[model samples]
Target: MKVAGRCGEGSEGMVRVARGPRSAAMPHLVRGMHRVLLALTACGVVAFAGPARADELTGTLKKIHDDGVVVLGVREASIPFSYFDGKRTVGYSQAIAMQIVDEIRKTLGMTQLRVHEITVTSSNRTPMLLNNQIDLECGSTTHTVERENVAAFSDSFFQYAVRMITRKNSGITDFRDLAGKPVVTTAGTSDERLLRSLNTEKQLNMRIMSARDHQEAFSAMKDGRAVAFVMDEPIVYGFKATDPHPDDFIVTGTPLGYEVYACMFRKGDESFRALVNRVIVRSQTSGDAERLYRQWFTQPIPPRGINVNFPLSEQNRALFAHPNDHALD
Candidate 1:
């Protein structure tokens, strides 16, 4: 399957809950009313339905309304997408999450809506979201069929490919070159799954290691713990560029897979998902997302002035031009 993030909005399956009580099951109630309305409309008896009222708010929105707080799942280090830039969480995804928060404030008319950032790793992010410990995650998470089976996702904002970073003298040109070599990827990421599958399917017998995060994976390669660091192309490039000896490493290899990234949340929060998608769709169509891409990928970024220099790909251009939640997988 390709890296499957969408450019448009989509709601797929079941969700966990928010950190608080969602006593107001407005979505279910609305669906029940919708059934009746559809039946009536078929008979030409009822033709109109109005918007939900304040008290009818449900799911994350309802939780936010009641609690006045929006919990955002943030990555401590995903680089350029989402990471702790020393003092705070900042990145392309972080900016998008903030936009969602702004819209949430407007939607609820709550001028004092507080944003709570919780650091999440690749493994725990989903569980935290499912358990209602966090509200939504906007990071470098790949939108996949497996993930959609449990959670909901916003429109696709970014697409990427699986690649690897290796030392220049390592002479690793592509996937085949890494055969029988020690390779590392972040634990719980799609890249790890892809690498393992490659090892098994091709019988490469590659010694695979899993780090907790991107930084750790990079460190593995830097410290000679692994011959290669595998991850998304841009992320590996980000790390390579930022390293003290930028020329010592290179991001190479035929992509193992293609995937898209999106904001994720509980499975059935229609209102909240809509709000998040609006922000994303707005950014794509308005050229805001592209600018952010240039800021993070092509330009120099924080703590150091390293320029990743990854240009936008044709697939992403198509995604931005025609936004949709179509999973590539």
Candidate 2:
């Protein structure tokens, strides 16, 4: 069945072995025809939108619905996607996750459904879900075949190019410039793996320092321990913005690879997966997705009230025009 906007294929992409895991500033035409190309893309998941049946609840939905609570996996500083704004979980992805939670509440007919949060990192997000510690991981998680081999991912929301950032005087404008220099990326991430492959494939032999998180990766670059910090473009831009001297850093390099970001959960549970996808499609079609993007990416955001100042790219505009579940690997 053609269910929603530009739909993606089934989990036919990379999944990182252990694996894991848009906004709206939208346009007027996108606003009007947002629900145009959605189709049933994933192999078996359906987009059924009927009312939730308590007696028939299953999987994650059943556990949360029966328990009257939903657990969220949040990030410490993934910037516009999922991050702590000092006090609360706030970001574009976090907003989308909350929308999903609201749908859960409505579907289960539990208005006062209690919601809780757990901090998850690149290393622990999957284990937390597989271990049933958190119901949904809402952050900048990429959907890949290896990861999908173990856990499950929702439909794609953001697509980005993996790149690196460095000081203006670092003389590293591209991947070729970092031969044997120390470069940092968050551990347990696709970016780290990609960098590793590039180091060997291109014979760069650069020292790869895998930090525990983006903050630490940025710190390595900032303190001159690492000449460059490799990460997704949007994330590195956010990191660049966080710098006291944003002008000192520039996000540059040829796009080594492309990937899609999606919400993650345990494998199986097609019903709950369908619910999550439906919420994302609705956001895309109803313009909630675009609004969220504008709010987080284009406008000023929390913590330091800094504006990422990143505009919606045309490629991303297409994703919003037609949402998909496909992964880039």
- Model 2: per-residue Cα lDDT over 1-329, one tens digit each: 24333333422211111212233566768744433312232322245634577888889989998788999999999998988887898999999999899888877878999999999999998998999999999799999888988899998999899999999999889999999899999999999899999999999999999999989999999999999999999999998887778999999999999999999988998888878987887677566788999999989788887888889888788897787889888
Q: What is the lDDT, from 0 to 100, of the residue 293 in candidate 2?
A: 92
After superposition, the stretches of candidate 1 with alpha carbons farther than 4 Å from their true spots are: 1-53
TM-score, cand. 1: 0.83
Q: Give the least accurate 10-residue stretch of model 2, judged by summed lDDT.
A: 11-20
Among the numbered candidates, top lDDT falls to 2
Task: Report lDDT (CA) for all predictions.
Answer: 0.82, 0.85
Which residue runs does candidate 2 get wrong by more than 4 Å?
A: 1-51
Cα deviation at 198, candidate 1, in Å, is 0.7
Candidates' TM-scores?
0.83, 0.85
lDDT of 2 at 36: 37
